[model samples]
Target: MTATAFTSPSLSGTEALLLDLEAERCDAMKRADFARLREILHPSLTHVHAKGQIDDYESYFRSGGTHVDYRQIDRSELKVQVLGNTALMTGRQLLVAVRKDGSGTVRIDSRVMQVWTEHEGRWRQLAFQTTPLAMSVT
Candidate 1:
């Protein structure tokens, strides 16, 4: 079977940088590396969870219970738009997570929207919101 092609074009350098930063953020999350998250997130960053909880950068790093082995992350349906120094990214993500237990695994599909800003020649995530996608009716 041939893989389908997906494309999302970025308009400016800031938008491009945000895409790279987001990739790094995913890698950091998979490794549970807080430092990487810190580097990519703005000091005033706000993260809205799937459950509608709001957390600041420090709070997010402090909250535990994030342990999971990520088998795969599929990011698609990306739409990036730039307005001045701010860029907005919306996409769908499919991630497979394996618990510490040797028993079973869980798959999560979500739609995410993230805002990024350029400050001092660097791009940082200013805000992020994610919502869980309903299961597919197959």
Candidate 2:
């Protein structure tokens, strides 16, 4: 993986737009709005869960509401960078959710990475991955 610096001098207009879209995506996940998510995610999307499972676009959507149901997502230390028509984002996420198996609420802290590509005048998320922190949040 190529490492690029995420120095926040100031966010450009493009960066700000992408950042908002990312936030909106998080909201969609929390509410289990599958239609909204489908609009925002790319057809070739790939997501690597914090637990180490990888999901393609189809499987990712299937997991939601079946394995885990997101309730809230709080992002911090988020950084966004734009390269041509693609944007890269990285941040820490505190996600609160419940298992579909009715175990209980789970609070997870993780490092997240996402890639968005501009297509047909709209940005669609192409890739996402999360790495869990050593200790999960309560």
Candidate 3:
């Protein structure tokens, strides 16, 4: 395994674009911007939460992003790699969110991995999974 700094000059153009798209996705989630998410997320998207919950594209989008009320997302230590038409992104994020059912606000410090693929000239996220860090790294 190799660690590359986010600002490293060795990153490929595709890697940089994926990182930007991922950032936009995080921002869209926090702001409840479904239109932007629709553009970024693939039709067969799979999202796995740090708490073991799973959501597919329809399940997540049908809820209109009301499943969680996101207060903030702090992403760091991001790395992106591109292989042919696929891109992989990994990062650490500190998220503050509350369940829509009034379950109270919770803070999550996790490591995230995302898969993005280019389809018909557009890059869309296909999969996302997060693992809670044993100790807070953020």
Residue 34 Cα positional deviation in candidate 3, in Å, after optimal superposition = 0.7
Worst 10 residues of 2 by lDDT: 1-10
True-structure lDDT of candidate 3: 0.80
Arrange candidates by lDDT, descending. 3, 2, 1
| Model 2 lDDT tens row, 1-138 | 101122244768777777777777888887788899898999899989877888898998787534778887888788887899998999988888888778777887889999999877899999998888843533
- Candidate 3 per-residue lDDT over residues 13-56, each given as its tens digit: 78777777877887899889999998999989999977677889
Instruction: Show model 3 residue runs off by greater than 4 Å.
Output: 1-8, 134-138
lDDT for each candidate structure: 0.72, 0.80, 0.80
RMSD of 1: 4.5
Give the Cα-based TM-score of candidate 2 against the true structure. 0.85
Give the Å shift of residue 57 in candidate 1: 0.4
lDDT of 2 at 53: 86
List the pairs of residues colliding in candidate 2.
Answer: none
17-123 per-residue lDDT for model 1 (tens digits):
56667777777777777887788888898998666889897887765225456666677776678888888899988767676565567676899999998867877
